[model samples]
Target chain A: AQSVTQPDIHITVSEGASLELRCNYSYGATPYLFWYVQSPGQGLQLLLKYFSGDTLVQGIKGFEAEFKRSQSSFNLRKPSVHWSDAAEYFCAVGAYTDKLIFGTGTRLQVFP
Target chain B: EPEVTQTPSHQVTQMGQEVILRCVPISNHLYFYWYRQILGQKVEFLVSFYNNEISEKSEIFDDQFSVERPDGSNFTLKIRSTKLEDSAMYFCASSGGTGLSDTQYFGPGTRLTVL
Candidate 1:
């Protein structure tokens, strides 16, 4: 079964600081990965996705993720996180089942 | 410029009652999907629809749940008899499959509460 693991449950970071959120996946074939963000009462906002080519992919809201095949990791990063970036982030895998397996998510707290 | 849209931002229903959540996907999108999130839990895929028929459904999408594209634009999810565990936020998404890969777009979601 394909699964996703988000190592952090909660992370606090100072404003304008670089951030990295860890994600690891278990999949047999070439994977399709995604990162999504959600505010307190809002639906998911797609950060970016990796299907094929270019290990580094850019997403909305100044977010980027690198897909590493060896480590089975697709980690999300941002050079500077704004206060508005305080939200729950989720990493998901798209499987042949036509369903998405999502991580428990990491709640980010941007401090000023 | 284009995004999925869901109706009735929030819904409250008693147990054993039926509830229908509605959504309108982006124009010209071929694949449609429904996913649910139980409060702070991970988002779980419920079902996917294409060509007016169901392409795939997860175990969570049991007989109690059904989907429909009754008209040309509306996609609806109906829960025949709601259970207490059914309380969650339901999200609608759509993607255009030109070939093999496509990015799915999501709506704001519908908050359903079963009291």
Candidate 2:
């Protein structure tokens, strides 16, 4: 059984500050990881994904994630936060059957 | 840019009535899926479809639920009888390939409300 865990329920950061959202997964083999963002009443937008190859993967909207096998973690980070970036972020692991198992999600709040 | 699209942005149905949710996946994509999210909960997979048959489904997708690619572009989900617990946002997703590595693009989602 594969699962994802997003420790932070909500995080508040000031504009121009750095942001890091933690994600951990439990899987038997190499997992496919993804980050998605959803605005209020909007569909999910894919931020980035990691299949294999490089440990660091860059996504849209200046977002990036690092995959660490040892800790079973794939954390999302942004160097500078903007108020428009405030939304709910979800971390997911792709299953062999092509279904995605998603985390509870972390709500980001950006303040000026 | 191509993206998945769904119909009936918000549906209000009475309990015990039937409801149909529609989706139009990316034109060239082959695999389609249905997922639901309860308010403030994680997105949960319901079923996956390919070649006009269900490839995989979760326990949540049971006897009461069925999916069909009725036409060339329309993919539909039918619920035999609506329940209060079924009130949630239903999302449609599609990928160009069948493999898990392929990126699955999501639609805006249909908010189903059962009264």
Write candidate 2's Cα lDDT for B35-75 as tens digits.
Answer: 99999999999999999999999999999999999999999
- Candidate 2: what lDDT? 0.95
lDDT over C-alpha atoms for residue B32 of model 1: 93
Candidate 2 C-alpha lDDT tens digits along A16-69:
999999999998777899999999999999999999999999999999999999
* Deviation (Å) of A2 in candidate 1: 0.9
Q: TM-score for all predictions?
A: 0.96, 0.97
Task: Give the distance in Å from residue A23's predicted Cα in candidate 1 to where it truly belongs.
Answer: 0.7
Tens-digit lDDT track for model 1 on B36-88? 99998999999999998999999999999999999888999999999999999
Best by TM-score: 2
